[model samples]
Target: MSEQFHAFQTEGEGTGSLVKRTVEDLPQGEVLIKVHYSGVNYKDGLALHKKAKIAKDYPMIPGIDLAGTVEHSDSPDFSKGQQVICTSYDLGTAHDGGYSQYARVPAAWVVSLPDNLSLKESMIIGTAGFTAALSIHRLEQNGLTPEDKPILVTGASGGVGSMAVDMLSGRGYHVTASTGRLEEEAYLKKLGAEEVVGREDVTPEKIRPLDKQKWAAAVDPTGGKVLAAILSNVKQHGSVAVSGLTAGVEVPTTVMPFILRGVDLLGIDSAYCPMPLRKEVWSRCAGSLKPRHMEETATEISLNGLQQALNDILESKIRGRVIVNLQK
Candidate 1:
């Protein structure tokens, strides 16, 4: 008998299909996971794009995140039937990933799912939420606190931005959500943003060496011009944590913000985060860092519904998180 499971397979030649693949066909790994939930991310959307160069190889399954019960394990660190999560670090890039009903992951890449988070909830807090948490953690590390000045979040209607807004607001920060989707102002306010501004509000009309300092700090996942504007606008001794490149990649700005204002530019990379820090942050996600509206921040979808979700994410039409519920 052969071990068979359903998976979304993408070819390097730029085509994708849902097919039945055998366990023997997956990449080498020590643990076999019975995936309960996965999450869609910007990277997952790009993995389907013909020119994105995201997937490291052909025949990839690009889900980037999953939470599940362990079906088999060769590593002593994890036991069969234990709940676990696998996200980033080549899961959906170079290796077989979470879009499948079953996934095999290297033990080194797995984490025990935090106690207070269910499989569904964990997937809701997937890569995007993790990135947000890491961003906030880095900001606070750099001496950012909830003060009179607000913390600005770019792309605030999207997953990372929305999560950043919720977490910052929950922690008593005055949050200013910057987004092109002004129609989502009510929703952003509901998530605790004190102010919601148009994306153009943060993006400068032209690149200035420096601007009048406004925000105490910012969480900017929309790199490019928006990031440059943020770099220039952050207060003296402030910090801006950046994660994505949704906008154009070129940053047309001068160095005066960092040198003169003493602002810090922090990079948030959740994918290859150190294991110790990853565990600590996950614990925070289950504890004090957990947001008030995680449920409202996410919507669940079945595997068959992934294509539309992928398209929506790529077009920036999707809001908040899209959790994937795998079917056996």
Candidate 2:
């Protein structure tokens, strides 16, 4: 007989319900993880709300990231009792995911938890922080540096944006955090943003191919008009690493920014990132890219708390990250 655990599942459009099941119900995989913590992401919210195409199947667990200890493994690279973190690679969407107390996942999807982070702290960083680090890595690889100029972090009140703001500021770069939540100005400052401005402050009424070059680089987790505005205003040789499409997916912009100013727009997809580079990024995140007050940036919830947390995230009423402590 196998042990059973509680998991949140999406049964159909606009419906999410919790279900109890045995470990044997999970899909076949080489490693079995006793999931300690899982984080809520925008995609998780979408899965819960049935607003996006995040779930490929009905009755699916919807946590994209998890940190845990290995209970069993057939793969030589991983062994019992080892702490590990798993993100992306279809953990939540196409397959049973980490929302449950236990998750069975492929060994190839696992990364050894770095020494600098605890299981709880790993969930604090989660998918959002990982994406922020990846954005920074892509920007740096494209020749961005602190000395270039101020880097703008759009949607700075949210998870990815907040992490980007903290990481960029920690690296001694001038960070301008843009957010619609002006009431959170002090919070943004505490995250190391040198300047905090409203969303409209960066967005102009008119759309131009290029405008005054205000930012040398930008980390945009919000798409739609905010992204369009950034592309029009970025400085010469500047780069924008775009991740989320929270505002909207369609981007209406002109080529003048790229053609006239030598600007570059880099896309960051933390999911399905190659293994070697993913490991490297996670290692760096556990090191220098680790955000200050990581714990402060996250609020922990339990399986029972997931319903309301999911609602809060979908409505954009939640701040920072929300971690679900399965064991709690």
Candidate 3:
């Protein structure tokens, strides 16, 4: 008989409830991982909501990021007992994902765990941190440097925002973090934010076509009026790397920032990012870009606690990262 394990599967309802599964139940893949840790992300939160339409089908697992050791492999690139991580692509959305004791994924979707990073630590950084690193990487590619003026990170208390703030500051950039929760000001500062501002401060009543230039560049995970506002205020020749749309899908802005100031609004697509760039970013995350406050930014939970955590993430009640420990 195939081995049986517990997994969070969504059926014909709101968010899927937990159910018992087996190795034979997983989708087609070349790699089988003994999942150790997975991180909760805003995408995972939305995936649990049936009406959100983040999943391609029912009975799918919702974790977008997972790190563990290999149990079996059909490809020579990975061997049994090797540490690895799987994120992005179709793992959590269209395929069986990491919200389980075990997961089988395509070998192409996997990355060898970089040295100096533990499996738990990799999950702590997860997809959110990967997106954050990608944002910084894109900005730097467009000529952004630490000597430039204040670098803004919106949604400062959440996963991507928190990681960006910590990583940017650690790289010698002066970071200004913005959040709706003024109560988390000290927390943001603790993560290396040089300045913390209220969400309302960035979302002005009426965003002008060309507002006064403020930041040299920005890493924005909250797209909407906040993104519009940020674009309007970026310094001449500056760039903005946007990765999320939690604020809303619609962005009300104009060409003035782009045409007049030569501003660049770079879209960050963490999903389906080419494997070469994905591996490079993960390397940085495990190296110089790794957040110094990683442990402090993560809240560990067990499989039994996933439902509540997903609900909290959608309600914006979660702070920093939430890592699910399968062994627990």
lDDT of 3 by residue, 1-328 (tens): 3868888887626566878998998898999999999999988878876688788888788799899999999999999999999999987888878899999999999999999899999998999999999999999999999999799999999999999999999999999999999899999999999899999899899989899999999999999899999999999999999999989989999989999999999999999999999999999998989889998999999988998898888888989999999878
Of the pair 2 and 3, which is ahead by lDDT? 3
Residue 108's C-alpha lDDT in candidate 3?
98
Candidate scoring better on TM-score of 1 and 3 = 3
Sliding window of 10 residues with minimal summed lDDT for model 1: 8-17
Q: Best candidate per lDDT, number?
A: 3
- Residue pairs clashing in model 3 are 10-16
Better of 2 and 3 by TM-score: 3
Candidates ranked by lDDT: 3, 1, 2
Query: What TM-score fits each model?
Result: 0.97, 0.98, 0.98
Query: Candidate 1 — what's its lDDT?
Result: 0.90
Question: 1 or 3: which has the higher lDDT?
Answer: 3
Instruction: Please provide, for model 2 over 154-224, each residue's C-alpha lDDT reduced to its tens digit, 9 standing for 90 to 100.
Output: 99989899899888888888999999899999999999999999988988677666778899999999988
